[model samples]
Target: MTDLVLRPMTPQDLGDVLALQAKGYPAALHDSAEAFLSRMALAPTLNLVAHDGGGLRGYLVSHPWAAGSPPPVDSVLPTAAPQDCWYVHDLSVAEAARGLGLARRLLIAGRDAAQALGLTRSELIAVEGAAPFWRRQGWSLPAIIAPELAAKAAGYGSSAVFMACEDIAAL
Candidate 1:
């Protein structure tokens, strides 16, 4: 973990980001280069990468989005990002780097960027049984979810959980 650096995600980093995705995420969770580029265009500052001088260790891809309506997985976002809340679209850490706290560090950095933009909340659809991990990070499931929203989340995976943190600045 020594020499690990957290920096704004750049276009040049997409190839490594995609490689990290293939290793760290389920095949179904993979998003295309077009999708990644769209988010980077929408909120470049909110997207981040962690590199340990060797290679990419982790990444956090987020953007301003409407709360309760997560964009579909692997799809490109709208030209203009909705400024409602911070939407954490993806967070992945290299298997070898998992125990070094890279994921949490990337998350905190993304949250700080969102807060600076005046976003008070954050939302994410946790796939692959990641809800518990997110819960530990201060995210919670809403008491009620719209049927349509639930269906959309199902597109992510049967186990997808739409979670949110109401007070972004607090964490």
Candidate 2:
């Protein structure tokens, strides 16, 4: 693999991101390309893309939790103040990009961005058999998941595990 370049997601990159998401999580429903593009534009910095010379290889999308919002368990809700928590909505690496550590790099980038913005914690929903992978990356399953999120994740035939890391340094 050539040197991987990481950059903020652009509107033009929506198709590629959605395609990768479909491929990476065939069993899970995802945001439409339009929705992804809109969110990316609104929070470009939090929507990161990693690319090799070939094309987009991986990406991670995150958003801060709403003020006074209970811990995220289902869909993310917008917050008024810059919440101390950052939620990792999605992270996917192309099949060809696997084993290259692109996912880890993207994750670290997200964590760094969150920390740079003064977020004290980072969280994500681990789907399918990804629990072990998140654990290896220093994320631990929390005691409970939000009820709303649990039902939403069930549609994907998997329960969402709440995982958290103390700081970007932990990545």
* Candidate 2: regions farther than 4 A off: 67-82, 144-156
Candidate 1 TM-score, C-alpha based: 0.97
Total backbone collisions, model 2:
2
Using Cα atoms with residue i matched to residue i, what is each candidate's TM-score against the true structure? 0.97, 0.82
**CA lDDT of each candidate?**
0.91, 0.71
- Highest TM-score among the candidates is held by which one? 1
Q: Pick the candidate with the highest lDDT.
A: 1
| Model 1 agreement with the true structure over 1-171: per-residue lDDT tens digits | 889999999989999999989987788889999999999989988999999878989999999998888999898988675789999999999988988788889999999999888999999999999999999898999999999989988999899988889998777
Residues 73-95 of candidate 2 have per-residue lDDT tens digits of: 23333334355677677889998
